[model samples]
Target chain A: MEQFIDVWIFGLGIATLTYAPPLIFAALGGLFSERSGIVNIALEGMMTAGAFFAIYVSVQTGSWVIGLVGAMLAGMALAALHAVATVTFQADQIVSGTAIILIAAGLVNFLNLTLFGAEGSPAELSTPPKPGGVSLLVPLALALVALTAFVVFKTPFGLRLRSVGEHPRAADTVGINVYRMRYIAVIISGALAGLGGAFISFNVSSYTENMVAGNGFIALAALIVGKWKPVPVLFACLLFGFSQGLASRLPFGSPELLNSIPYIITLVALAGFVGKSVAPAAVGKPYVKH
Target chain B: MTRRINAEAILVPFLAVIAAMAVGMVLTYLVTGWDPFAAYGSLIRGAVGSPSAIGATMLRSAPIILTGLSVMVAFRAGLFNIGGNGQAIMGLILAGVVGIKLGSLPGASHWIVALVGAAIAGGLWGALAGFLKVARGAHEVVVTIMLNYIAIRFGEYLLGLGGPLQEKGSSIPASKSFETSAQLPVFWRPDPFTEVHVGVLVALLAAGFAWFLIGRTALGYQIRAVGLQPDAAEYGGMSVTKITVIAMFIAGAFAGLGGAVATLGELERLQKSELAVIQIGFAGIAVSLLGRNTAFGCLFAGLLMGALDSGAVGIQNDNTLPSGVATKLIGVIQGVIVLFVGIDLVFRRLSNRIVGVFGERGGSGMVKS
Candidate 1:
């Protein structure tokens, strides 16, 4: 009994740590874009780009920090493309986001083929030294979550941002620069999401194709289940993480069944909790300055 | 007398494609230092230069057409069915299992049994999202995406060594080879060069059927009406709930058929682990977008994409550029084109102004549908 308890506790800890950074960063990122009236479903794609570019650059430069920086820039670049399509050009948010996701996947696979080849050659990178029992990025992610909560609930800028999302036309009447706010929000969101990607590459291990996996989408689900609030979002992320960890540590049954736990949890959450909630009035609609 | 050129619609998509291809060529050259002309030569030859290549392209296009229709069907009902991948995979697994079990039956009956199984599996999988959306008001986008992961994991589990579908006394992580009678028949010999089958014809026919349904039916009208304006549709006495459920079921069926074609017609076995993550479902979204959600448009888009995919191998073999580069190139092109299309209304407005200066002849540029 004691041994089982210990294993469970250990699994919980690891899962919490694993899910924290990416989930927190992605949720906060979603908050920024969605709060500013732009539905940023491209979070997954942006994170993937960040992960791939960070590792690619880090491998070449031998600096993890620089790799992190590269990831941010790459994410921002992709986000800017999305912004141009959805914000400036007034395209459909879902289509633009889908495009971004596909483009990111394509770019990563393309670069992988060019750099490593089809046989999945591992890219060599200088491992950034880290203290045992969880890396610095996890702490950074928690801090980010707290910071986001403060900004969205307590700050004037945050209020304006939320108003923009809730009613862009109303915000525009009140002299809020809807376009500018949304652009800034998306860019910031991209940067945070990119950081999440970098954490995976530098801290977890050398990057692999599809390394960000479906975490981006999972974070999006957390945002929805949490009702787009940072604090609640954190709890949602933790729950998902815990489930994932438990699934991974199970002693019996095939590991494949374990791999599906998070998805099943997400489905349940979506079905059970998310139905009663409502999204921002202007969530997916582009704010055209007519 | 003025001649209006729907030039922007034609030109924009055309230019976007050309631009993307040019960028792709440059990227390939930069990566591999291969001659651009030679690389393209190989691409063309691989896709259409020979009988086998043509067959291969057609085979690749089969699922894309169905998946594209799946997306189109959902979009027409104002839902984004990103779960096409999941639905298609479920269909494939169901077809595989049934195909194996019903091997004793006559070939025609066997095919019917497998196909029916696939349709049911895919339909139920899709209806899961629809049920959630209506019952809980959860966004289909998020739910569908989550379901995709579940489907993938489920597929992996079903194909595991200890799973029911696994071959007898075989250690591989895949199902047993399907009976010959269960396999989709080839239209012609693969010319000793490529693998293509009659599945391509099925895909083409499916596209036509989708077009006729969407453009010429009362059910399609309800879907379109709801898509255009849900509140107005409700005001007009249309049952939004029923439309949503039915539309999703139809969409799921199309995707399920796509998987059946690939499994029964192409692979002749259920290599779930290897075949599960092929991205045909997601790529179908690009096809739908490029085709502008029209049936004929999907056919052409699927063919173009299928050809490009088939050519990727040739590019790898013939050039120093990696095989995956073509795939990436297709992705970039797809994104750019969709982006352009997303802003198409604005572009149309601008072109209308330009044409006004020329004459009234250019005013008919807007697509009525």
Candidate 2:
């Protein structure tokens, strides 16, 4: 029984901490974008590119730090394109995000095939992070949760972002450059999401096509379930990670059934938990100066 | 309630398609260097050069068109129906059950029962999201996406290991063979190898039905009113809640029917582990967007997308380029098309140039952002 308790602690701890922070990081990414008035369904795409670049550049530079920075830059580049389409050209946010996802999925796969001539590239970092499958990046992601919350809620930048999301036109009138704020918020969101992707590649030997899978989407769900806040969103990601970890670990129930828990929670939450689930007022709409 | 059909409407989409194709051509040139012109020539030829090839394209299009209509309808009602995938999967699962479990029914009746059951399942699932929006103020985008995950898992379980819906004595995750009468009958058998089922007709009928419903019906007017201005719609005695629910139900039903037809018409039995390739539901969004939420627009867009798919497969089979590279090229092109479609300026500017250069009259349908 004592051994059982220890095992359970070990299992649950691994499930909660190591597995969940990446999702939290990705969710934070979604929070910045959606809270700033852009619907970023392309978090998945951003993460995918992040994972690819994390491995690709890390392999080339022989340094994880460079790989991580490269991953963030790659994600920002993708987010910049999204910003251009939705912010500058006034494209539909959802459609433009979806386009980014499609473009990323195709480009990553094509590049992998063309460059590597295989489905995945080898992990080339000499140190090759493997401390009980935990890395400094995981803790960095967790720290960022608090950091992001403080920066977003406590700082002037956060106030402007929230104002722009709530009323871009009003923000524009107040000399708040809504477009620039949205662009910055979305780019940051993409960078964080990319970091999550980089974490995935760093954990594993190579980056696989569709490796990020639906984690970016699940992270999006976490953002919505957390009501687009940082601390609550971190808890939400933990819950999802716990559920996903539980689903993946314990060998009793069907894995599919386990996988369905987070989604079910999201459904019930969205179906009116206590009050209405409200997003930022201007979320999903392109901000146009009137 | 007549929508102005401008020449810009026609020219813009055409230019977008051409530009997207050019991008694909350039990507192919850079990546594979496999004679972009020849590859494109074969792509066009494979799609329309042969009657049998056109049949194949139509067959591939049958489900995509229905799903496209599904998204188009929801968009018309001012809702993003991203759960078409989930809804379609529900339809497929329920339809599969009806097809396999319902014994001793007449052949045609059995198929009809399956199809109807699938539609109901999908409709109910879709309506659930709308209900959440009306009651809980939950955003449909999140709800639909989350529901998609649930639907996919539930479908997997039903067809997965120890699933009640699984076939008798089958170890793999799969449903039993659908009843013979349940299959959609083929119309033209120019090539025994190619499939040109009556699902094509069903697709056409569904498109026409969506057109009439959105264009001529009072319900459609209410939906459009709610979509265009929900606040104004609420003040004008229209029940925005009811319109949203009904619109979602119809949208889900269309996609559900698409799924049922795809399963019944396209294949003999359910593919056990096909969750990875079930992108048709999400792909429908692009088609609907390209069509601009119009039924006739979806029809042409569906055909264009179908040709792309068929052309990609042709490219893959002929070994003109690496299979993975060629397929990715197609995806890149489709992605480019959607991006251009989302940004109307690209097409509008090009259309303006054409009008200024060729037309005697000045044309203007540019939507100022």
Give the number of the best model, judged by TM-score.
2
lDDT of 2 by residue, B302-329 (tens): 9888898788777766664446776677
Alpha-carbon runs more than 4 Å astray in model 2: A123-128, B1-3, B320-324, B360-369
Task: Give interface RMSD, per candidate.
Answer: 2.1, 1.7
Model 2 error, position A53 (Å) = 3.0
i-RMSD of model 2 (Å, 1 decimal): 1.7
Error of 2 at A67 (Å): 3.2
Model 2 lDDT tens row, A18-115: 56877887899999998899989999889998888888888888888898898899889889989999988889888898788888888877877776
DockQ for every prediction shown: 0.64, 0.63
lDDT of 1 by residue, A1-290 (tens): 88867667765786678766787787788888987878888888888888877777887788778888888898888888888888888888888888788778887778777776766535567545656667777777888888998888899889888998998899999898988888888898899889878777776556677778678887787787777888888887888777666666666776667767767766777677535446677899887787
lDDT of each: 0.79, 0.83
Off by over 4 Å in 1: A1-6, A118-124, A272-275, B1-12, B29-37, B320-323, B345-369
